[model samples]
Target: MSTPPPALATPLSGPRFQQTSADLYAQMRRTHGPVAPVLLDADVPAWLVLGYREVQYVVSNPEIFGRDSRRWNAWDRVPPDWPLLPLLAYQPTMMFAEGAEHRRRAAALDEALGAVDQFELGARAQQVADRLVDAFAGRGEADLITEYADGIPLPVVARMIGVPDAETADLVSDVYRTHAAGEGANEAYARVRDKVRRMVESKRRAPGPDVTSRLLAHPAALADEEITEDLLHLMNAGQLPTAYWIGNTLRLMLTDDRFAMTLAGGRRSVGQALNEVLWEDTPTQNFPGRFAVHDLRLGGRQIRQGDLLILGLAAANQDPLVRPVPQASTGNQAYLSFSHGEHRCPYAAQEIAKVIAEAAIEVLLDRLPDVGLAVPAGTLAWRPSPLFRGLAALPVRFTPAW
Candidate 1:
């Protein structure tokens, strides 16, 4: 039998952290076992949990590893300029709450999302997809990521929350950049937050059959400030990764001959295609800004109180300890794509994400059977944000409808 490896000594964000490579997973497991210390952009020390069981342990035991940033190291050593700050910094939403507070806020949010009719949501998704395809079908070639993938979610989400599509369409165009490193990240975040807050206010005054109005009506009776924060989180959740899931899944269908054949044969449902991506290339990759509540030893490593802990959903999905059959799609909660625990994404949100992605993608494939990548798959560049795994662009050519 082989020996277990020694835990890595220094916090290192080695090259593996940058790319989606099998080599990265191998290195993470070999160098540090399941859990390892790694540096965030500015050499900020944090634990990167890469094992399937190990990640489940951290997320499930929130009392030990809390989500509140106030509990983060008292040193205040991590600066605002830290590149990962945009993604890691705590916010006053269900994603950052702990204990009873988490349950309370998550329920309020779920109720708000539940007000959305699934059939309408799916129909709207297809409508958005149809509009997008009409915009470029006559051109014969277009960038699917920007022109299509990124385009579907914003309008659909806007309609769900009572926000007019015309008002949010241009603003949300920059939503993905909120978590990206470098210029305008903070400004982009602020802009989208302000815009969503306005929608909440609009809902308060006029109240409609949309999510924002439902949140105002929920018994949780959240203050406007809390509501704003929650809606901002929702905007982030509803837009960014869902957009990428559509793109990544489309990439699979267009480039992977296996998926292409599956689509052509009509033997597999589009929902199954989406589940396969959620298993293999989950778009909502790494997330949750969990912090250790006290000095403790976990996964063969000593974690200090306040030490930042991030769940490596992407890595965990590919963890060797777990056998994930990507081909098997039903009820694969085993993958931490949407995360798990008290802070898991709401079931309503989950339903919308799946239906929207599946509907939008199915619309495109049915309309443009001959669509294909303009550039080679390897030539595509993934956005560098550590939070969401997304492509920079997916240039594709389709037989012109004109």
Candidate 2:
């Protein structure tokens, strides 16, 4: 006999996804096993893969669970302007591409990102950090999320991808809107898409040492639309998670006694804190993930063809079977913060993001050695986002240096 679905589905959004998700995931695991049923924004049903082994199996075995969003069985229930269409709607980009086509685009993206000089990128991040800190240093207090952590990645990424200086701010705004899934998300996605197309045209006219130029000139010989669409994927995917990574790390350093003791000049601990955040508080919590290729059993649940499986990255990291004790995990990079397998975030891109985040955190500490949370740490609010984990605001106080 076939296994039946759970009686009630957990909504992927709202307070359940907020501060208490660890508890929530625990409940789901107890009630529904490794693969728990879930409902997206508009009552669209899917499964949240919560076990470490189960998540790994799903992402690694793409032959069974594919990346093609077009194969989703719930599309008929989705509206054209559904807030999540920007994320779920199929695009020709490598994010939704599968098989040989995915390999083609992934190769170009990997090579292009790999070509970036890590040392130069680190130096560039420091420079960006210095300029940003300069703006808020004399104020004695600032919201680090808006003024610091949220500000670092986009400018560095824009320069990396050859987005013109003048256009970077607007691009940042649109990307934020689309990721936040606000009322204007659809329009924001359209604007960002058009902007990337124009950027590809500009790069073609005069190729530079940027990622876009490299993609255009790569041996893969990607077409304009391919490059343009992937660039949109590249920019949007790179910025938000990275920004949240930085924010979450800073929050850890400020709030936790383990890291707070290092606030003054514990430069070495910055890396430790960053690694811990990945394991405990990964930026991308639940990735809208692979669709089942055929009916099969996964983690004791009966999965159907075209069934969507959300890879629970955070929940998987917390799986008792894999995670080490808290003290032992500071140096452990075994976490699945970056999804695993063929379609995982490229190794090259992960290194670049680390350089950017580490530099942002280190530079802030170097400049404002006494920086501490301006509000009671307990009062800080997390952004009301289901897909990403980040603080809505990170206010801090420091001695004025001017």
**C-alpha lDDT values of all predictions:** 0.77, 0.89
lDDT of 2: 0.89
Q: lDDT tens string, model 2, 1-402?
A: 222335788987786577678789889988888889988777778899999999999988989999999888888777777888899899899999988999999999999999999999999899989999999999999999988888888889989999987888898889989988768899999999998899999999999999999999999999999999998988887889999999999999999998888789969799989999998889999998899899999988888888889999998988877764654664768788899998899999999999999999999999999999989987877887668999999999999988
Q: Flag clash pairs in model 2.
A: none
TM-scores of the models, in the order given: 0.92, 0.97
* 200 Cα displacement, candidate 2 (Å): 0.5
Expressed as tens digits, the lDDT of each residue in 113-139 for candidate 1 is 877889999999999899989999999
Candidate 1 ranges with C-alpha deviation above 4 Å:
1-18, 264-269, 324-331
TM-score, candidate number 2: 0.97
Error of 2 at 195 (Å): 0.8
Candidates in order: C-alpha RMSD to true structure: 4.1, 2.0
